[model samples]
Target: MTTMRQLKKRAQFLKAARGRKIVRRGFVLQAVAHNEDCDLGPALGYTVTKRVGNAPQRNRIKRRLRALSKEFAEKFDPNFNYVLIGRQEALHEPFNELKKNLARALEKIHVERSAASHAIDRKSKS
Candidate 1:
């Protein structure tokens, strides 16, 4: 499950950039807040571009992100918006390495911890 809900459309992802914060050392994860049009209230959104690769490659990255995020959802602030942009190697990275990369990305971005996000994730799981 996602702590920050998946962002909906292309326009929504476009509206999300209040400040682009970097978290990890290797990856560049951008956090963009959506407009009110985004009723995410408690969820966040995601966007992966074609630049990443063909359908299969892109899908692999997205799947990895979903699994990685859910495993560490408690660390992310749920109310904030985030869009994961896959780098060229994103598809080929090992799962644990990707999780570490994501954690580092969050750390680099200085994404603050939100108790509510953890609570939300826990609640959702239960």
Candidate 2:
């Protein structure tokens, strides 16, 4: 039952860009393991730029992304920071499909991260 912190700083978003990324039909998800040790859950950020649409459309996309984050918050690792970048299709995409894609994205990110860490461990042991 961990609550997520909002990622508000510019640097926080930039840092997350260096981590694993999953692109979906409606959005792109980026996750980076946090360096600082803290009790708070994963930090989350949402972005829907002018490239997607006008102010109203962008707002709609952001709203959907906010809901998506809340629904999938538990799916993310507690030590990671995540950013969801909304696409133009997000405005018209079905909610259920969006959720499905997000779930898949989360699974891929988790798998990739674990594999990377395992590789590092193997390298150190060699």
Candidate 3:
């Protein structure tokens, strides 16, 4: 089982927020390439706003996100930093469903990234 590197700084989370964002029912996933440290593997950060719930409820959302991160660690791109913003729905959602959503979200992020790069390549060639 691979353990993901944890993002500890506020700056790290904020930087990811400026990158690609994928919104799902359970949570929001933000990902950005960290060119400075690609060899460290993917780093993960979790945040739950007060609007979602009180202290205990927010903590539960973070816990569920941690589990999902662990299960999909290898699927994450090593060069990217990711932040997961927990939503209120996360607390009531089934674990299996959350897992499926996460998988789909990751796939979508990479696909979009590749498509964007292809567009850039075409522009440079013209």
Candidate 4:
């Protein structure tokens, strides 16, 4: 399994927000796959904004998201930086369901990425 790193800088999370994203029941997942120049494994950031809840509530939401993200760490692309935005429902959602959602989101991200790459290649060939 590839090593996992925490995304500490605000800029790193902001960068990932510009990438492909998938909305799941418990969270919004955004990912940007890195180029060959980056050799590190997947880096993750978890955030629950003030709009979501108070400090304690937001902290709880972030904790759940962290656990779910860790459980499905291998599902994430090794070369990508990911940000998981916690949702209110995340507090009450079943743990297993959250895991499934994460897996599904990862699969969708890969599909969309591959399609985009293929289109870019075709455009360059023309």
**Local distance difference test values of all predictions, in order:** 0.62, 0.90, 0.94, 0.88
Q: Candidate 1's error at 41, in angstroms?
A: 7.0
Query: For candidate 2, which ten residues in a row score worst on lDDT?
Result: 33-42
**lDDT-superior candidate, 1 or 4:** 4
Question: lDDT of candidate 1 vs native?
Answer: 0.62
Candidate 3 per-residue lDDT, tens place, 1-126, comes to 555789999999999999999999999999999976676788999999999989999999999999999989999998899999999999999999999999999999999999999999999999
Choose 2 or 3, whichever is better by TM-score. 3
Best-fitting candidate, scored by lDDT: 3
Please identify which of the two predictions, 3 or 4, would achieve the higher lDDT against the true structure: 3
Worst 10 residues of 1 by lDDT: 33-42
Please name the candidate that would achieve the greatest TM-score relative to the true structure.
3
User: What lDDT is reached at residue 89 by model 3?
Assistant: 99
Off by over 4 Å in 4: 35-39
Q: With candidate 1 superimposed using the best TM-score fit, by how many Å does residue 50's alpha carbon deviate from the native?
A: 2.1
Sort by lDDT, best first: 3, 2, 4, 1
- Cα lDDT tens digits, model 2, 25-50, are 99999999898665887889999888
lDDT of 3 at 62: 100
For 1-126, candidate 1 gives per-residue lDDT tens digits of 433566677665665555565644324566644344333333445445787778887777777777767776766654457766666676676777888887777765543444545778999999
Worst 10 residues of 3 by lDDT: 33-42
